[model samples]
Target: MGVQRLKGKIKLISVFIVCLIITVFPVVTHAMRGDCGYEGGISSGEAPNKSSFEYQEVCFITGEPIVFKGTLKIKKTYKNNIINTTYIYNLDNAEKKATLTRTLNYRTEITEKDNGQITEKTYFQKDPYEVIKIDNVTYTLKNYDFTRSSFIDQKPSINFYSGDIWNKKTYQTGGVNSGRSTVTVEATGNFYGYDQYWGSAETQIINYVISSESVKNGKIDKWTGTAKVTLSLTTTKQLKYEENLPEQSSYKGVYMEKQYNESILEYSCKLPEFDSKGVSTDIIKTKSGSLKIETFPQSQPLSVPDISHLRGHWAENDIRILYSLEIFKGDSSIFNPEQYISRAEFVSAIVEAAKEVPKDPAFEKKNTRTAAARKKKEEEVISPFIDVSTKSEYFASINAAYDRGIVSGDGGRFRPNEPITLADALVILVRSVGLEGMAPGKYPVTTFRDNDLIPYYARQAAFVAQEIGLVKGDTRGYLNPNEKLTKARAAALINNFINYMREGIKKVYTEGIVNYN
Candidate 1:
């Protein structure tokens, strides 16, 4: 009777164990399925919620193309066995999106060669979808479920532990006009693995094998065996943001953060190799490739520097105007209006005015000068004066004036600190206005009583200076060309030059006539 009770107890225990297995299997299977979609159990439903609308625009103003071409040769060695795989990809036809603030449109072509067969595929982006059209059949792909599909997808989920499995899916439309065509992907990977190809602790390495298939109308369109993929992630040094406003210098310490993903896909059969291309068909086209994200500061009203001695002076307005334009920086806020200006100071002021001020009112819209053009001009001019060192502040300006034949040195000595005479000032002013060669070989005669006092070399320059209203004699009508140029007179002369250039005055001088309008 005891033996019979033992057998019955064993049967009851077996029945209970069977019931537990039946009940818990489905629950475990469902939990595993939930974790299969993404690297960190991230589901496809979670993607749209994480999509960012706060995009920074990058415009290519010149419409220059961005080209990417590479050939990936992957070799895997285990014991005495070696496997080699080659993947060739080319991305081109990338141009500025005219309608979008910071967008690019491009096409990508990928080729895989293995087992003596070559397979080629091309992809492009249409609004809200990635389309691959081949032989009059369009395969539209939507809802990319993977973080890293290709280079076009800037973000990819690479943070996963060893022995993790994930699944991805993309919905397809067009081609065959049947039920939904779906591409299903299953990947198993070991993240945090070490590989020599990637090197160092600076990179995150992932080794994975993925299987993918496309089903159309309940039939398989294509399928693939396990494809080995080795991927590495390296965070590069941040790139600086360039601003379009010329006056606002770039903030050197600020940079945009970027992550670079390098991956190699090795497969012997057809497998889906694309995520979303990040190409937006709805783009804003602009004539400028540069993106303007912030409001730029406008030029404020000119501030007149205080010069106490110039109060109620005859040349006060001229001094204020030149100072407002930043052409004349008075020493210690004292203009010293009666002090004579040196030759070096005069040339430096002329160069600064030419670069900072616009040639005409119409040109004022372009407020910034071209830095590249200025540097090029500086490089083209070599200093011929022994007194001017390359490190001198006025070296470039003096060299530039000399290159244009506007100013010449005396016996190879610049005499930069020497006071400039009225005759020499006239020559420099006339040449600055594009009238260097317009002077006649001989002037008929001047009514000034002091014409004989003017040197022979400055005769024509003196005549042109008077004709252009750039200079005027004293009340006695005596042209004192030999007198040293004072700070106030220099300011007035430069102000007149500014007016001449801004007014767009054109001058035509015949044998004996001067016509200007």
Candidate 2:
């Protein structure tokens, strides 16, 4: 009897356990299925969004082809590793009731290579790709029910401009003198224009903060700041054209702040905007003009020791040569004889003088006949780097200066409106003249002790100039090359070069006359 009772209890327990396993296994399976699909588990039932846009991305190296990439996104709360996945759709025009699915189809080719042999393969990801397309638009998955998407582009553009504003009066007071400017940018491109095979474009808001401001005269001249902005995934309607879009978009542009650099005058800041992931980053576009963030007064004070009373002492011939070369245009046609010269203008003059010597890299890509035709139309001259289309006028002199290599640009960025310095001018002049044979003479006399400041390569040129009376000492007996070159000093220096050249010609002529006689 005891054995029988034990057997019955065992049988009953086995049946109960089997029933429990049957009930719990299906529930768990259903939950797992709900995690990743369009089954409307805990997420909305919808597809991802799409758009079509183009960007010119500069490569890390110079002269490299620009790399172009596209992005798309889906809006669903579902997430599955095997099949379909969902994403949060917070765009401005998204429908709360619907979900989004997305996929990326790069029209790429595949190449197959075997050892000692190579085979070329060509494949184009056609529009409306059936394999990649899920319910609306998505990359394929094993289960296919997940709402969270496998692919999306989470970046958008935010750029703009504000006009120039200056506080010139405040500069003299030793306060932070600055100028102000701003830029406003609206979304210009969208990814949805591409075929339906790809998912809609999307972005995730990370941080939208101010980037930087403009600078003037080497100071924090002007800057910008951004107001807080909200992210919008989709537009209220389609953005068929740039003009059709309103000035105000759901995603506001990033802000900017300015800082001053005393060495620079005209300053520009790259625009700030959202990256592919909707994070704030500097927006730089070659097509769109760079952001001019600030303008500041960049004048430095003259030291008491370097101030000299000597002013006007140059000949007409020298000035003419320099002027024709666009090197030295005299300070006030009257030629002031007793004025303190600034160091900045001096550098510019010397650079201009060097430009008189011809250099190539000009006329490289020009249609010479056409350029000459417009010579009088304000389009004849411009810096090699400046735009010839709209800013042809101001760039005339700059263009001439750049070609001679008298003045070089800063990291490919040129500050056209900045002032020049005396030392800066001397360096450019020394380099531009190619003073290979012009070594200093062994004359046992010296005036300026700081003549040693000239670099060894430049020493030969400086010494020769001194020997030939091209560079004269100031009243205080100092060669203030580091000082800002004033217009007056520029005139004087140019005159000196002309004299040097003429005296040599005279010497040669006299020797010839003697030999003939």
Deviation (Å) of 234 in candidate 1: 56
For candidate 1, write residues 1-517 as lDDT tens digits: 0001111111111111111111111110000111111222111110111212111211111112112221111111122211121211211222321221111122323333342222222221322323333333333445433222211110011111122323343435445555444443344443332111111111112222332234433555443323333222211111223334555643212223222222221112222333244222223332211111111111124443666567789998787667766788656266688889999988877765543211111111223445543342212223466677655778767877665445666656677888888887776766544443456665435567898887776677777777777777999999898898898888888877665443223111111111111
Window of ten residues with lowest summed lDDT in model 1: 26-35
**Steric clash count of candidate 1:** 12
Q: What are the RMSD figures for all models against the true structure?
A: 31.9, 36.7
Worst 10 residues of 2 by lDDT: 189-198
Report the lDDT of model 1 for residue 368: 41
Which candidate's TM-score is highest?
1
Q: How many Å off is the CA of 50 in candidate 1? A: 37
| Clash number by candidate, in order | 12, 85
Candidate 2 TM-score versus the reference: 0.27
**CA lDDT for candidate 1:** 0.40
Off by over 4 Å in 1: 1-300, 330-332, 354-382, 442-444, 504-517
**Tens-place lDDT digits, model 2, residues 469-500:** 76766787777655655555666666565444
